[model samples]
Target: MPSSTPLHTPFCDLLGCRYPILQAGMGGVARAELVVAVAGAGGFGCLGMVRESPDLIRQQVDQVRALTSNPFAVNLIPSATDPDLFRAELDECVRLRIPVLMFFWDVVADAVARAKDAGCLVIHQVGSVEHAKRAEAAGADMIIAQGVEAGGHVHGMVSSLVLLPQVVDAVSIPVVGSGGFASGRSLVAALALGAHGIHCGTAFLATKESFAHDVHKQKILSATECDTIHTDAFAINWPPHSNVRVLKTEVTESIESQPYGHLPDKIPRRVVAEEQGRPIYWMSTDSPLKSMTGDLEKLAMYAGQVTGQITQIEDVQTVIHRIVAEAEATLQQLSNRS
Candidate 1:
């Protein structure tokens, strides 16, 4: 990939953002700095709102607002509870009059109406064409096609390579492709397949502003696609069918040897140690450096299949700018010969 696409060629009218390169909203990893940095760099940044209390969401929103007057989105976890859990946060969005609201997981009708009532743009992330249609009917202004290659929770067997084009045709609204996008060539491929923009998580996890633990970042940098594995190890406490794309480690190996549907009586003690700020050979819930630990060899370094493409750590702004430039150049090269 080369730097050739105009810096602002792909603008997201749905969210009124300048760049089509979105910093994927990652829970526990997405922080104010990461959001602001990407937004400041001309791309839209999303703050992951899963597990956040209403007050925390409001505070994050206010913090992002103060940092940049630019339009940023709040990635809402619609699957967590009834819409009631997010009612207060929804009210705040209405109060602040935020421009973009991207919902992941379950999309409830009332949630859409509330955001719409506030004049907020609604974007929904889905894994299948069925979900895409549902989101659109629920009043989504856009749909994010999250393929199986995605890092955290993979929703469907549909991969980005196949799912993007399918959802694009299925929906009248904008279709954004996600799942393992780490380079401009990937973005170019996505656009050619009918995607309007790109949604990325793992790429942003390696950036300077990411709140991930230092060890986590290192693991990603060191890993290849084969080094990563998808497992339900975290699902014991997290979401069912909960899959995480993590660098293969002792924990994953141990978990994989167990019978299906079996859960550990207790989370590995390493999880607590990691959370308490101690280093461990395996990632546990307790790994405080979960976001950017740079120690993927022993941590739950969540990533996509594209983890193979990432080899270095870069500043958030540089990463954003480079992706856009490379995408443009690749597209232009194709256009020139054609």
Candidate 2:
């Protein structure tokens, strides 16, 4: 259903953007093509910076820059990233004068100040009221309240529907609602709850330009809302531990059944597990390469709780356009009812 009310807000104003929809900075799965596609379509595209080295970050920044001149943000994992590597990447952003810098994991005041000093709009991703408060205190221009329904790693266990309004009520700064949002109806709900914008991940993950493999996209299209499970299985074996929201498959089920801290034993420790000789799950990297390779049934397929709501893989432009149009229509209808 489309929103009947015309949706317009401030977060969409500063950047001179047409829509308040934000393409989530999905770690592991976020790529240059996907970010550029969303940004070109009038939404903010974000590059996930977790696990990316300075060189890789530079290459990605160059790639995104080459694709589109539109504004985009880089998602930074503060804790996991090495201080020097992080600083170098930060310097690169300062040099490029990136439009936005979205920080996750933990917001350090010094780093926040540096980004601000460089003139980048800083948006911090948080899960709870406390985290929101801290981010705001640290000088975050915006806060992304990511609920448990969010895919990839999450900081809070609260659902977006519940967490968004609470955080909006508690904080004076702009709050962008995230988690389980894959459509305009979700966008309307976020704005109604006082959020300045909606951050979508799962919906974008199934797009044509997404880095997600074909098998994984099929799984996302076939999934139901009840198919998702948050597990620390991948985190247990990887460094810079992070949680994951994945579809409940055989591999995920086996890991979930085991007690915490025993992931390696439960799943056969493959030093060099590969799909067609290309290493997928490398013990050295904490990244979710398993999903990147064509192995959805055995590897992790991270998706939001709204996975079941998705039924097909569509073009990125079409997906973004539909969300904005539907959101506007839905908002219009709601306004008429009142």
Candidate 3:
């Protein structure tokens, strides 16, 4: 898998992947299995280890290393993790010599510098151009301009159609577009938006290797573009004023739903589910992991607007292969017309 394809861009060399597709290191979904599958298939992946223990991080890194030599990333959210725990997780990645350290939420400048000092490439996902500039000033190697149409926890109000090119122009580093991207046509559109690569969450969440529950995958398959809702109903464990996009459900439409972007921390929280004995509180910043049990429909079902584009559950290899082939075809069509 060399960068000889028509879809290859400068970001391909930065990620050391054949295609300019990077699996979104979605917390609770993009685990070791999915990361390896994507990397082995010529796309880059990031392990979603946000708020995870140091021991678990080491175990996952070991698993990925044993399975594939392709460089992968470990995702961490400083805004969601405890200070001490964040330090420990950062230390673990640095100690393991992880190739890439991907971050979300408010950019932690010192953490970025430390990871870079440890010889790790730092990718900071930002929602606004000012923050993108801040990340670059903090020594981030790349930036992911996440639009409001993204799944899970959304960071910005603008759509990819508007925010992506602005962020690319605002920063000198390679910019990757996130949100509302799930197909080869979207990938070509991302390139047209001046993004060097595409970072996808909803697309990979439905893949066979994803850690998402079967119910979650099925919902995406059956959903449409209009089925996504962006609200702050699931902001228990994260920062206040957190905006998240999830599949529309009874929970979201119920009378108990919080006022948009305004959920009181004092709201009653019940343990609605568990993953490997870890409790998942209601309205927490987590979706149903594959290992989760109990009544999960009462919990969050994070999905992007792109969920509408997914119809079937494919393996990571097939997903990447199809996207690349389709992107190539799209490029040829444009060339023919010109």
Candidate 4:
């Protein structure tokens, strides 16, 4: 049951959302429908635009605007893709007048300034306290402290429990705690740790509106905390040492059997099962997209340790309400105990 009283925090006020929960801008999976559903449900939604073209981004942005009038964000991994293409996407985001833009992996000061000048709020996701401070200095409106427990290309080695407080203490800007957050209990815990909000990826990936394949969502639902393994096997196609937390599969087993230097330079396009004529990249780091259809088990099925807590796929509204309601109850119980 949802609490009679709404849970309000600084993060809610800052993002103008009914709750402080943020659906992560997971590349390849966070699409327009997911973003609109989350935004419409009073939680902040972020569109993962890292792998999208400028034209697709424009279409998605327009689609989101048509669905909801609420504020939403677009996430870009500036350092992960081609520079010219990234610049084009950035220009499109500014041209579309996006309310918020999030950058992960590395921060570009000049690009940050340009987005700010265009009236877009900039949020940077970092893994360390030093990076949080650097984001603050670079004029970020907020920072997402991504811990080692996060799925897909994690940034640092610290756990969220330890990293959140360190980041909160380091920067004046509002800090969002990411990695392994799945439910209201964790949301309340993050708030207790001084985080302004929580950013959830693996949990959201299992939602009905997510673009992830059905098998992918079921994999998360059936997984336990111990089922996920962190390794750099998928990072061979991306930057070296870019570790990922994913469900252990035969593909991972095969990768583990070989020496790091023996891995293939690129995963052939034919190995991916996707829509006919759709452009598929050679990177093993790419998640299974909705358009993908073949060899689903062989692709990267990214998830977090929190997958153990997700038993079923629910609509975005139900997920948000349940978290808010549960957090409210927990907070009240704690208050009474004191």
Candidate 5:
């Protein structure tokens, strides 16, 4: 059944989910387990397939389908992915008849058109009102207006409190607020801002089903809202100039004192760890995953400013249900006001 009272919004109708909450497809953290749990719990789940090979995308897509018939999305980063690989990903997704493709970083018009042509609903996560308008112009079915305080690749500098409403007013499509949102209060705040939903990365990253390494999860649990630092120091593998908001580590402390510019993109990548036999490079945007082993600090420990609100770990279903119950209670309280 669908949600009610500020929990259900147009985003639910667009994605065919019971609630408008979306688990952001954070690379490495979002996998089949988390996606299935989220979808089964009546919220949207997206596979974090950023810059991955098409074969892996297919396998993960199949894995999610095997668990549930619910609608989910595969997230891809266009501006950061290799052109050839990006095209191949789109082709494979189209061939598989993927229900939705959630894109971030930039709104690639041609790629979005290709997905649309295949009858796939397109979602683009943007940082600014300009990009939101461009995504709308490009026929994106929904827009996740991400703020600078978000974990991982941050494209906009403004906080969601100011950015979400700006985006909601700028676009005709239903908008979802991203960055610094975790609890039911945050959902009510987003609704008040005219947003239809919330895209949560850090909150889901701490869930039991999340594929993040235990060490990384602990760090997030130990962090506060002020503990996250936004910087471009981890853009070695992807395109330069893209920024990420990660937990303050020994590395980020030094980077925070300097300018937020990218290291030379062509610099040699030092392998700091291995996950499922794949080399995890130093200064890469790859979040620590469960299969990862090595110097975990070398990789980005992505988290959002909402870390202050997250204290313990829970399963995906419990987190969603609690948030919904809280949102209902909050709505009732607000309704009783003068």
Candidate 6:
């Protein structure tokens, strides 16, 4: 049965979802099951396809298709991807008839044209008004205005409260606000700020269906807004000198004590024995996905300033329904007051 919830927005209609909530394509974390769960719950779910093989992308997409007929998105970070591999992934997405394609870090005109030609909606994630305008001119279907408060690799320096309105004013296309959003109040605030929807990352990391390790989820639940620190410490694993937001772990503390460009030359690795007594080496910068078993506490625990709002771990459906229901009630109250 379709939800009778009064929380309706143009973004939801455009994406064919019941709510205007999009799961952030956190690399290595947004897997097939999480996407299926979010999409099935009436919110858009996106697969994080960065650094993934074409075959794995196909398998994940196929799994999502088998679970839900609803629309979902696939995110690709062009700057982090090999040109040929990105082309292959794009081709697979087109052949599989995926509905949405999202790009971050850098815009690829050819990929945008190809996805559009294949009848797919293209969303570009931007950190500034200029990038948002560029995305609009590049034939993007929509834009996600990501602020510096976002977890993981944040590309912009402005906060969501300041950037969303600017991007909305600068772009003719629909704009979604990301960074520091975890509640219905924040969703309503995004709409008030002229955003058609909200893009959330840290909040979803605490969800039961997320691929993040249990320890990481617990850390998210226990963390306060001040528990997160944004720095270029973990950039050595991916793009050098890039800024990232992660939990305040001992590793981060050590990095903070060092001068810029004077950090360790070697990537920290932890060895853990598998079920069969086979040892596996894990990188400290890798996301704490369930497939990984190691010193998760010492690795990067990417979370946003909204971590304070995420007090518990719930299923995707519950999370979506609660946010929508709260927003509807809040809107109703505001309307009555006026």
lDDT of 3 by residue, 261-298 (tens): 55647657789898888888887777887889988887
Clashes of each: 26, 15, 0, 2, 0, 0
Shift of residue 30 alpha carbon in model 3, Å = 0.9
Q: How well does candidate 4 score on lDDT at residue 317? A: 87
| Cα lDDT for residue 78, candidate 6 | 72
* Cα lDDT for residue 46, candidate 6: 98
What TM-score number comes out for model 2? 0.88
For candidate 1, write residues 1-338 as lDDT tens digits. Answer: 11223533334655656668877778778878899998887778988776566777878888888888888888776665355667776776678777888887766888888898888888898888998999999999888999988887666777899999999999888888899787888888888899888898989988888888777778778888888676656543354455566676665787666513533344444432433353443334222244334344454557888888888988888887788788878978998998
Q: Give the per-residue lDDT digits (tens) of candidate 6, residues 288-335.
A: 778766566766789999998889999998998888888888898899
What TM-score number comes out for model 3? Answer: 0.97
Worst 10 residues of 5 by lDDT: 258-267
Better of 2 and 4 by TM-score: 4
Candidate 4: tens digits of C-alpha lDDT, residues 46-103 = 9998857999899999999988888989998877778898899999999999999999
User: CA shift at 209, candidate 4, in angstroms?
Assistant: 0.5
Per-residue lDDT of candidate 2, residues 1-338 (tens digit) = 11223565777775546678888887666788898898888888898766566676778889999988888898876666777877887887788777899998676889899999888899999889998998899889998999988987788879898999999998898899999787899888898899988888889888888876777788888889988877667653343345678787766656566513534334445543354454555222233333344333566677888888889899889998898788878877887999
Model 5 regions more than 4 Å off = 1-6, 266-268
Better of 2 and 3 by TM-score: 3
Q: Which predicted model would earn the best lDDT?
A: 3
Q: Write the per-residue lDDT of candidate 5 for residues 254-282, one digit (tens) a residue.
A: 67886376675654689999978888888
Q: What TM-score would each prediction reach against the true structure?
A: 0.87, 0.88, 0.97, 0.93, 0.97, 0.92
- Cα deviation in Å at residue 178, candidate 4? 0.6
RMSD list, candidates in order? 4.1, 3.7, 1.3, 2.7, 1.3, 2.7
TM-score of 6: 0.92
Model 2 segments more than 4 A misplaced: 1-5, 236-241, 258-269, 272-279, 282-297
